[model samples]
Target: MISLQEENDLIDQILGGKQEAYARLVDNYKSYAYTIALKILNNRPEAEEAAQDGFIKAYQYLKSFNRKARFSTWLYRIIFNTAISYKRKNRVQMESIEHNDRGEESRESDLERSDKEVFIARAMEHLNEADRLAIQLYYIKEFSLDEVAEMMGQRVNTLKVRVHRARQRLADELTKILKEEALTL
Candidate 1:
């Protein structure tokens, strides 16, 4: 992670006609931006496009970025908004395909973990979009509550409540799912 001073210097260089400085910023934030987009769009291709578009938009609007907030927070907000827009525009639901390339060393444990992941994913599907986003940003992405709130454009307290409620709902759903699975065993 770049220090705040370094980030500011890069922003200054970008604003002063040193366009290459922007690449550093993009490199620093691209994975995070793509993750945010993936969380929203759930499609790898669309998420990648949205992250790129967000970077372009950020570059275009860089001059207007007041130094009040961290550049990352600002850039992530742009990424989040861009991804949301893409999600709205593409209303068609697409399932994400993930490839597992683990060797045979831990197949049994991997299967157990995969089963748990499927159950948790099913429980996550029960959450409303906002709650799901809030929880994912706060927990899965390991963003601070304040950062997640700012990115989501919600008050910190509101986001905290959303996260709490979402966790409760997930727990309930998981328990129900486990019970059903147990009955079938």
Candidate 2:
């Protein structure tokens, strides 16, 4: 594997005149970029999109990247920031409306919701942004719980509780929806 310094040097070369050098850089860092995007966005198509955007940005801003950081590290930060911005901009920020106490169907039918988000993702949608992010970082993104806690800016125990509760809520909601669907048929 090429060292990050080597990669940065290569990028400098590419910007200098060896434009074909972009191919090598792309081959080297594309997957890493995509994974970071996926981790942030959770949608494969959106991940691909953010990855493409990051590559373009990297190319356009290659001159702006000082040699202070490792190439991959800087690239990772670019994709991470881009993915986060893209998600925030694209996401439908649901208001936390109170569960209607008197309107069972409203709440129950709402409970029937399932996002096209994967198994973990559908469950994740139930959580508010904080809980969803905590759960994704700790579980799906496979960050250590401690790492997740740090990233989420919360106590480790609090992150643990959030992950646990998020999972439970997802399970309960999925089961309820599945059972309802079965009865409807």
Q: Candidate 2 overall Cα lDDT vs. reference?
A: 0.70
For each of the candidates, the C-alpha root-mean-square deviation to the true structure, in angstroms, is 5.1, 7.8
Q: After superposition, how far is residue 54 of candidate 1 from its true place, in Å?
A: 0.4
> In model 2, what are the clashing residue pairs, if there are any?
none
In TM-score terms, candidate 1 sits at 0.87
TM-score of each: 0.87, 0.55
Model 2's TM-score against the true structure: 0.55
Residue 36 accuracy (lDDT) in model 2: 63
lDDT of 1 at 59: 100
* Candidate 1 C-alpha lDDT tens digits along 1-185: 89999999999999999999999999999999999998897767889999999999999999999899888889999999999999877664322222232233235445767888878877998999999999988874568999999999999999999999999999999999999999999
**Could you tell me how far off, in angstroms, the CA of residue 138 lies in candidate 2 after the best superposition?**
7.1
